[model samples]
Target chain A: MGGGITLEHFLVLGLILFLLGAYCVLTRRNAIGILLGIELMLNAANINYLAFAFFGGARYDGQIFAIFVIMLAAAEAVIGLAVILAIYQNLRTIDVDATETLSG
Target chain B: MLNSLAAQAIFYVIAALTVGFAALVAFSRNIVYSAFALVGALMGVAGVYILLAADFVAMVQVLLYVGGIVVLTIFAVMLTQGIGDLAVSNRAVGPGAGLAVVALAGAVMLYATLRTPWHLATAVAVASTTYGIGNAFLGVYVLPFEIASLVLLAALVGAVTISRQDTPPPADGAAEKGRS
Candidate 1:
């Protein structure tokens, strides 16, 4: 409120988003839901990177890191979905609880 | 005064959109609904990037996330048949335990964030971050940049190979293809 916004605001927001992702990951039964949670967590980290970069006066570093993070997330999503598809093909279900062939 | 007020207002709006939709994404029972909610959450994150003056990153977020990842998620959801039906239980396991853990983790992060003495510089004129980032990737960070592209290539190949392994048997012919 003093001069508009602060790094703390961004950091707090990122934390909330990160926690939400964690919550989803913990609770969701679907593998794709877990993947979505992971994506959310990555984005939360991106927010922190940009906030620090902007406040620390090293703008490009944070932006570059965010770019890499985004690329990694995309790659992860592709591989994950493919794995999920394969799992469904093999087991005929995408439920993490039900697909326990390796549990023993 | 008015400008700062406007910025603060915008920040609040974006923050709400981000957190609210993210919660929806996390808790929604329908897989398709969850994917769609993720689109809103991701867009809010892009708005946050714009607020941080990372214009290039924001555009990339919109492009890669909104246009690509979200669409791909929805497509995957559509392709998988049982996901839409209630046969797939999307409910969270032990809701109390999960929320408790989230609360604890949120508390720890909030504490660390508030306690840390972050070195903040006076706000300066932010030239386009795109130029600097592009230059660094071409210069100092070139190796990492190339590696990221390689990762993408590998992922592309791997995805196709993995998903294509279960070709419909020729004996079952049309029936198996229709069933799949």
Candidate 2:
């Protein structure tokens, strides 16, 4: 069980995921794109949790935490999209540049 | 050496596809394409989880993110078709190099954290861990779980309310029971 795949492999994957997610969030201006970025970041953390759970030879606390993270991400997306719709209804756009009336 | 060779081959394939698709998602101008690329990246991660032997989590990843979230995003993209079509600023990706730098720094930090010393529990502890997770979810984390469900309920209500007023049911929405 502990012969081939190791914790290090999981950790590196999680790191790459984290970086990709951060780049997505920072660069995208569209509301949904931003939301996807956030989802990616959340999933990166979740991956880490699962990897550690299985490979760090720990109790399933990490897995439990990952499950919670997934649930929370779903809830967040729903709420975020709703908010985006509300904003779009009033302003008719999702560009962060255009919706900066209150950015002060 | 043979085991690592096999693993490396698989990892290289997944890593290339995952990073490439993820970059497309971040760089693509079209919102729908970005969503599609995100789905691709997510599916890749799920595959990695499978390779890591976390079968349950991998399935959940595919089901929740790819099936549920990606589908919902596509529906949203279809709904907002008119909005996304308008010409966006060509310079949306300004200072792309700076953002890349930040991402690189974050990547390094995360790698360092992962490499830092962490205690590893014994296999006996790992053996009952799955059951422990279940009991912990119910026993210790129940309150948060219940609260999260309520939040989801609220989101459902909010989604209905938002998508209702501006656009009435046009058969696309299919909210017609007796309205037609």
Candidate 3:
């Protein structure tokens, strides 16, 4: 471990993670998988906040927003899961492809 | 040279893990595996935060994302299905276009970075991320915090109402015949 690190390292890592999350969002069929993708996307934003805070002048402001993002993610998970449960109750299957019942 | 060597090694390890786990989460077909991959990716992100001297935010990343959100996702996957879906893995989307777009975007960023002359003074970047975060929690961010709490409250109530299924009463009035 180094005594200290630099900004480039953090930025590169954030980029890679953000791309991965984006890929997941584009391809996942499971509603929960989509939610996980959203989680990654939000996390990528969090990384940006921390990086800006450390390297730029946006310190506390970034962390506070990141904290709110995390809280919002948790809330999203709860509501998403509830919605998923309701879908399961109606269709008996969790596949997103199968939820074409309301295509009209 | 030695100082940079250490930074380079730590950077590679954490960066590799973050990218690898994120790719896994994005590509893995089994929903549960994706959730688990999210845990790994989230931890790597926390590591990156720590590297940036944002120790408090890093801990929060571990606590809320890796610990809470990922675990919640796993429990949800378990609740909805049997063990069969665990084996049911398949690629659902074509990632080539997305990959191309990301690569192009990365190239643009790189070009922009190279085009600009960055400040190189040894600015003592002491990341007091926690102090700032604390101030926000008690200051301008209080309204958003309260609103988030309300959203959580609504989610809990909504979940309870949706999950609890009340039994329907006998439509033919079997209770009356039984009483007679």
Candidate 4:
């Protein structure tokens, strides 16, 4: 007579999402694609936060962390995209592999 | 019991939607498709938040993540030329090594999650968490909240400066310099 959904279920989902985001980060050449991967990883972290809040305690601490994470993700995306645009202006390419002006 | 069963079903559906679209985001060759697929994946995450009784977080996820961040990402993708063209290879390089590493990491995480003895709390009544969250933000977490806003302001200024510095000199500036 137990509830079917367990904490493990949610944690496993977060794990899967995190791994997928890692894969995206490792494989994609597009700078924006890498940014997308980072976003995925952040969302996975958010999932873990809410899941823990739901099952670990009666506190709203986890939800607060999730909100903070969302805000940070927005800031990161804004800065990352701005950097990408600047790189494009300098190099005229968005391919992470090809943008090597900094290598010197 | 029946209600619990129905909740379990919804949970599985949302989990599937989240993971499936996440896979699409990882594998799609078209960057636009991947960006759009991220929308579905993030929406699924929001749905899971609702299932966890976090109504406020879910709404914020949809509004900020799906509405703002994803749209900004799509615009960035479009602004960077040659990314949208299918001729450009969006294919994953070093496939074998990447897959192996992902598998190894995923397996470790799954094992850890399933094996950990999590301190499970009794299912308490789901109260209005939005109020509690807001109160905490304005009360105990006020310092962190203010710091977050400050960080955001700094990031805004930094982004504007970074973008502005790279822009080619305006015609007026160039003419002024020539006249000088």
Q: Whose lDDT is greatest here? A: 1
lDDT of 4: 0.86
Residue B174 shift from truth in candidate 2, angstroms? 18
RMSD of each: 2.8, 4.6, 5.1, 3.1
- Cand. 1 Cα-lDDT: 0.87
Candidate 4 deviant stretches above 4 angstroms: A1-3, B1-3, B85-93, B165-180
DockQ of each: 0.66, 0.42, 0.50, 0.66
Candidate rank order under TM-score:
1, 4, 3, 2
Clashing pairs in 1: none
Tens-digit per-residue lDDT, A1-102, candidate 3: 245555555655666666667666666567787788888888887887777665665567767777778888887887888788778777777777778888
* Proportion of true contacts reproduced by candidate 1: 0.70
Model 1: per-residue Cα lDDT over A37-87, one tens digit each: 998999999999999998888888889999999999999999999999888
Q: Candidate 4's residue-wise lDDT over B19-124, tens digit each?
A: 9999989878878888999999999999988888889999999999999999999999888887763433335456567789999988888888888888988776
lDDT digits (tens) for residues B18-69 of candidate 3: 8888888877756777778888888988887777667887888889888888
TM-score for all predictions? Answer: 0.93, 0.79, 0.80, 0.92
Per residue, candidate 1 scores C-alpha lDDT tens digits across B73-169 of 8888877767753433334456788889899989988999999999987776967777788899999899999999899999999998898856657
Worst 10 residues of 2 chain B by lDDT: B121-130
C-alpha lDDT values of all predictions:
0.87, 0.70, 0.72, 0.86
lDDT of 4 at A16: 87
CAPRI verdict (incorrect, acceptable, medium, high) for model 3: medium
At residue B99, what lDDT does model 1 achieve? 88
- Candidate 1: where are CA atoms >4 Å away? A1-3, B1-3, B85-93, B167-180
Error of 2 at A33 (Å): 1.2
Candidate with the larger TM-score of 1 and 2: 1
